[model samples]
Target: MSTTTREAAGRCPRCGAAVHGDGRFVVWCAACDWNVDPAPPDEDRGRPARVRRALARRHGEHLLAETTDGGAPGPRRDPAALAAYAIALLVHGVTVVLAVGGTWFLVTGWGRPLMAVGLFLLALAWTLRPRPHRPPEDGTPILARADAPELYALIDEVAGVVGTRGADLVVVDAGVNASVTTCGVRGRRLLTLGLPLWEILTPQQRIALLGHEFGHYSNGDARHGRVLATAYRSLTTWRYYFAPAPDPSLLDLLVNLLSLPPRAVVHGVLALLDQLTLRATRRAEYLADSAAARAGSTEAAVGLMDRLLVADSAMTTLRREGNAAQVVRRGTEAGDRADGLWERLVADTESIPEGEYERQRRVGALRGHSVDSTHPPTHLRRARLLSATPVPAAVAMTGGRARAIAAELAATRRTVARHIVRHGFPG
Candidate 1:
């Protein structure tokens, strides 16, 4: 009779244990240590209530409520929008001027068709520009199963508040920074994290970092970035095309000579336009940091900023060391050969650092060597993050939900680091 009763109660699919009814669609099985369901449960019907009960068991109802309610306003895009608008106007004005001026000169017959073809090609390039690819499979899968579920849950919760799609998650083996990318038209969004970044940040700090990245997604920055990049490329193409080619024809020569003044004027206008665009990009970074603060605690955001600076410093040190090693190796190989002028010069340089202490001194000097860098200095980024104000409660309440998801990402770095140490790099 007992066996019959046990069989009547559905067993957990995973553990094969008998289950008892939980009033909701779920049945709890103590023996199997799992919940079993005959059918998919409706999330809207009882999930929230069940979740509330579960949270209450762990954190108490008050703490749970506080966590659910506590949020800061996300960063505002007003400055970015205004800057973008200004750039658009500048671009439009320049384009109009170029079109009109080019048309006027097109009376030379050869110039007219060439200019038109050039403009068409530029437009095509903008429209068909390729996007950056997803990080390769050889990259790290930073987040493990245990961490990923929690992270996804947090993302779902936050996405509800923001009324937007949660970021798509990916982990790259590259030890570096994190960035969010977008794909698809309206509903699809992709977010990627670097394994090195995951390894370095604590849970709260990770949450803060993710908040900033998602803020960019929520603000539609990906779309805006794409537009800006495409437009910039298109403009460059147009500028090149309309530029005068070497001409033997007298009429072409005359037109080219006359066009020089207008072209110079256009160049200045474009420079102003470029400045505006760059200013907007800088402002966007500030806004994203503010968004991070709003989504998580200001303290968490600040911590993340600090960690990022530390990581960047570490990377810089590594790169310098690698460069020094290469230089020394090259110098040694050249000395062994003793064949050419270049080799002799390198051998002589290597001879200058004869002892360990002298080599160390040389390496130390090389540390100060300045290489042209693409991004702004880390100090500037840190200063900006520090100076930024905390996001408003109202904005945080809705915008900051994604912060919790980042908290779940804390374990990812450890898993990735372990794998990396054990397996070496994924090829």
Candidate 2:
């Protein structure tokens, strides 16, 4: 319900008078006779039923009930859960083993007392391993200063509909992509948009994009993602330090001969843990997409897909051009002719801004990466949105509008393609 005001006095959109008003809901442009109220009152807004229904459809009714009813489903202490548990166990077990072993070795005069001290230190390090903690900042610095006020507003509106706290907005000076990261004392959530994407998407498309990011945050996808990352890190650490080894050096060989079996057991356990974490991550992505559909407009989800594709295509062209230019500039600087027709083509394309080129490249890269990565492919996601049945009327309206927008976007892509072919992509 709290609103922030813009500093400058502006002419009323309806009447030409200097005025002050809240920027969130109302904007008065005096000279052009423009008074724009972009958002509705807070009390009248709530999470959309369509979003709930879609979530129920994808994740089942019980999931929503669990989140709202405050039922402790307890920890997901399954096999993967066991893996995390095992790490704790191993830490304790190793400490006991070292303490006992060091005492015996010292009593028997088989090794120096320093070995006992060293083992204790190692045990302590394992037991007190630093977990990934959120950064201290409550808000994302990048989102706060990015050029797109409308994008942030849209995200806030959608957050209202889903009954989730809005993420701190962030802007990466990158191109054609968006992602949500959690930072803060407890890993509080943050949403980041690429600058190029802000300049490119229409208002509706932008809302859909924000919806996707919110979907991830609302569904606890970020937490699940972090878990998976942690599991991988744990697995790698165990493998690197504790795995058994055959060593050629006489002293090293003696050490490995003693530790190999236990190390191998630990390695196997961690590998199993890694697999369980990965499965959880993939499931989380699907659930988040469902949440996004439930939180705001299903149409927004679909429109977001279309815009993503458009942005990707644009970026691809830009990257190709950018690389070519880099090669030519280097060749020219070295007094060598830029040879090869393909090389010439690349050089011609490289005149575009580096920021713009990087944006396009990132989009293209996202398409390739999302496949093996946790997030589902964009085309598959779009299909899921379209196939979702028995949609509520409000969601239907939003979806209908979104479809129209997608059609327009498709046409626009074709126009841009033609222009690129003729002009070698705009600068």
Candidate 3:
């Protein structure tokens, strides 16, 4: 250690080294990268305020067009986007009917059998479809209420604020993301929270994360979630099923030749729907971000997102540090052993000077904004939040309650860490 290494009043829990902070929220140790800290509510100018302010001042006018809260006539009813999926399904049904009835047309010898054969090939593709891909699963240990009552209670408290009654299951995972999804035809709702995300933010930010997720439920995004997921998967199935020419067998060769036209048609339809959904999805993200800001404070909601980016980047360092095969086999127990990885990640991020940190955040925002993905740019989302009215979201879960939630999620986090280290972070 350098002779200049001075001890501070507070020590890093992760590294057992003297840590420093601006006396609130943001905390880190220079010796190790345990930069995670609970954020203070109502204030977070932190060390980067000047840089953020300068950037804001530079882009002040553009902020107005970003719109205030509740103002964006978001694609509440994105007819064009929604219609593409509906029409695609209709076309699929028609093709199914044609495939079945086209054989009779062939018997009449009045029509070419190739089209009928193509239709039949399309139908066969549906049968050969792979199982629907479930929403991203962390494969971590599931925590029953009995195992973590304090945590479940905190969840219920947050749930009340977010306006969802509760979830069927709570999955503890490794990344810095949380999501709500439906599990089965019965529409069982599942809420999964990533501990790395939780570990970095304050109590308020935690609520913001949960609020953002449940916002999906309140905004009817959950309903749309299931439908679109099915649509995407079904689209994928046909794409995969009819994708390749059959093997050289006579029967395979004939079917392969016939499937081509139908395959082309489905490909064209899939491309159209994907483009439409991207727009709808971007709108949905803004709406959800809006809901989260309203449910938690804008600061917390936005901070959660900002810090989440850091956590996400930090998680990648573990790729070379963990045994994927062992984690896949041992689950949470394996994650428990790699507990310090999060600390290491945090330390690395924290060691960077404020200027560099801000630079990186800005560069990341700029570079990421151009991606051909469904979600909107992080900078745009932040801009919208900055322009919108700030609401102080009421949260009953705080202080001791918050700590308990953290403690309860510990075991689940360990297992999730294994899953992440084993399989890697989800995109």
Candidate 4:
């Protein structure tokens, strides 16, 4: 059940304006946003800001236009997708050649120094081998059906409604986002639900989130396909191994010079692959959003997108709460802050005004902010969701069942909150 809502608590320290929140949540001025998001924005590591924004704006504008025109492309045999597969196969061919050549060399030069070359080639092949997705071994406990029957049942219901198999495993964590991915050699589905995100969302929004993630499975996301995915991983490994050494010594400089050509070649292939799959990947996301709407209704899906737009702020709020906990506990026996941690987060997020959401929408448009580099811009997603025909939710979240799921998650909520309060979020 959700916490009770309270009225204005105090004045904003920065703006001398009304600060509205329950005491458990941070009191912040909506006018100045003081204490609303204290953490600095995360650094962008993937692409230059200018380039990302440009691409996002272009894609977003084009997609919005297409949505308006009712010409959104459906699943089709994209030449770009086929080209990406071809490139991936070509990349895998290199590994095959190395493996075969190494075997031949070892056989022909059994007792010769050429056997050393064979070992080297074999090692290179191993390094470049296609890697399948694997379940993360991080210490977070996995929630099997036996452990959380209600939660799993809910997920299964949503998956069924969304036309995909239920996740084989579920992980609860401190993040402000959720995702579903195929993991393990057998391609078992895994769903990672961020408690922070879950805490702030309504039950229907949660259903929408799950539907959107599982939608990737039935939607044929180009990025998730085995061939291209493994090829991307292999290329990344190649990049890492061939990357130039920092502050190079003389010998390191010689090695770097030797590796320069292969590094350049690997880089070119990676870029080409990215370009080839870019459109298909973006289209897949929209299709997933459609699935989300189909499962949870357009209103809930739109609400989910709004939640995503403010996710960074949500993270920032959690970080600040964690820091506050640390400060309050200083010089005292370290104690549990987990109990009210979620209540505070829920309050803080709920305290945010509609104006703040509008501000975030504008900021997203100007900066092309998205859930990630791969997703389309949040404003565009919201616009598209709103533009689509509204439908009734296929999966219902009854209060009794919602409470059962919460009860199932009770221990996990505390554990995740305790971790966040102690160490802040992992990068």
Best by lDDT: 4
Judge candidate 2 at residue 378 and give its lDDT: 51
Give all candidates' CA lDDT scores: 0.46, 0.47, 0.60, 0.78
lDDT by residue for model 3 (240-274), tens: 76865645688788877888898888777665665
| lDDT minimum window of 10 residues, candidate 1 | 367-376
Summed backbone clashes in each candidate are 8, 13, 4, 0
Stretches > 4 Å off in candidate 1: 1-147, 156-164, 169-171, 184-187, 219-225, 236-270, 316-427
Look at candidate 4 and tell me the lDDT of residue 292.
Answer: 84
Ranking by lDDT: 4, 3, 2, 1
- Candidate 3 residue 399 C-alpha distance from true site, Å: 1.6
Cα lDDT of model 2 by residue, 1-427, tens digit: 1112344456664666776543222334434424322332232121222332233244422333343244212224356555555664564455466556656555665367666665665564454343453432532234342444443545666766544667664534334577776654476666655534643554454665666566655554423445444544444565567544554588778877777787767656544443434444444555555555554456666655655555544465454544444554343422222122223323323332333333333333333322233344455555556666423212222555555544433333333333333334333
lDDT of 4 by residue, 264-364 (tens): 89888887887777766877788888888888888999999988877866887787767766767553522446677888778878876675676666665
Clashing pairs in 3: 33-346, 33-347, 34-347, 332-415
Q: Worst 10-residue stretch by lDDT in candidate 4?
A: 46-55
Per-model TM-score versus the true fold: 0.45, 0.48, 0.66, 0.85
66 in model 2: Cα distance from truth in Å?
Answer: 18
> Which runs of model 3 end up more than 4 angstroms from their true locations?
1-75, 88-139, 244-260, 323-339, 349-352, 417-427
| Comparing 3 and 4 on lDDT, the stronger one | 4
